[model samples]
Target: MQNLLSIVIIGIGATAVMDLWGALRKPLLGVPPPNYAMLGRWIAHMTHGQFCHKSIAASPSIAAEQIIGWVAHYLTGIAFAALLIGISGPAWIQNPTMGPAFAVGTGTIAAPFLLMQPGMGAGFAGSKMPNPNAARLQSLLTHMAFGLGLYLSGLAVSLIC
Candidate 1:
């Protein structure tokens, strides 16, 4: 139960960090992030093997791809939190540094490379993008930001409560 809660917190925190980073970087660099909602949709489509294009970006899926993706997303976090709990035990669950946030953040590098980039038709981790190097960098940065967010948010929670 505690592990679940920690994972949820880490996931939310990481998402927030990614959002804030995009917002801050967008104005200065005129770079826009890929649509998060669209990303979510793409993830949802994972179970149905519909990872082609975003033709149905705005539509709903009967195959439960979207729901599955959302659930998987949260579950990933939970899994990370569980890892942290296992590694550090209960005492570190609320540590905020080496606990929930760290575990969640550390685990984020895989999604974009394996799932997200491929779904976006960019190949694994953006290898099929126009510029593979830039795409890979973007994926790394975003994932890193997410991980940092997880860590920071967990820290905040620990400090506050």
Candidate 2:
């Protein structure tokens, strides 16, 4: 029960931290925040046995895509948080450290680089992006930010516990 609470908070906090980075990227790097609705469209298509697309933007819109994207985004965060604790042990929640969090955050790069990007037609490591290097950097930095978030959230949760 205690671990559950910590997991939820840490997950949401880390995810929000990633979102914060996305928000700031627009001003800092001239890159707009990601459109989760596009992710939603991708997921929606999955329900119809379509997993890959030439361009997610060109994909047809589905009902409640925005809502679906937002929900899935947060849920993914929570799942990642769980993964962190699972790998680092529940004691991580009691005494959070940067090592595990950082490793997990950076390791999560695989998801987008290997799966999400290709599935969304962004190519591996966002190679299909207009500026592939920039896209890759953005993705890397975002994941790193998520790691920072996890560590910070764990510290906060530890204090509360």
Best of the candidates, lDDT: 2
**Residue range 1-161, candidate 2, lDDT tens digits:** 98988999999999999999999999998989989998888898999999999999988999999989999999999999999999999999998999999999888889889998999999998999999998898899999999999999999999988
- Cα displacement (angstroms), candidate 1, residue 101, comes to 4.5
Candidate 2, residue 44: CA error in Å? 0.8
lDDT of 1 at 33: 63
- Reference-based TM-score of each model: 0.69, 0.97
User: Which lDDT values do the candidates have, in the order given?
Assistant: 0.63, 0.93
Screening candidate 2 with a backbone cut-off below 3 angstroms (N, C-alpha, C), the clashing residue pairs are none
Question: Looking at model 2, which ten-residue stretch has the lowest summed lDDT?
Answer: 103-112
Residue-wise lDDT of candidate 1 within 1-161, one digit each (tens)? 65567657756666667667777767866768655555566766655677666343544644555455556555665565556556666665466564444445656668778866666666776777678987676666766677677667667767765
Tell me which residue pairs clash in candidate 1.
44-65, 44-66, 105-147
Reference-based lDDT, residue 82, model 1: 55
lDDT of 2 at 52: 94
C-alpha RMSD of each candidate structure in angstroms: 4.1, 0.8
True lDDT of residue 111, candidate 2: 89
The candidate 1 region of ten consecutive residues with least summed lDDT is 54-63
Candidate 1 residues lying further than 4 Å off, grouped into runs, are 44-49, 52-88, 98-106
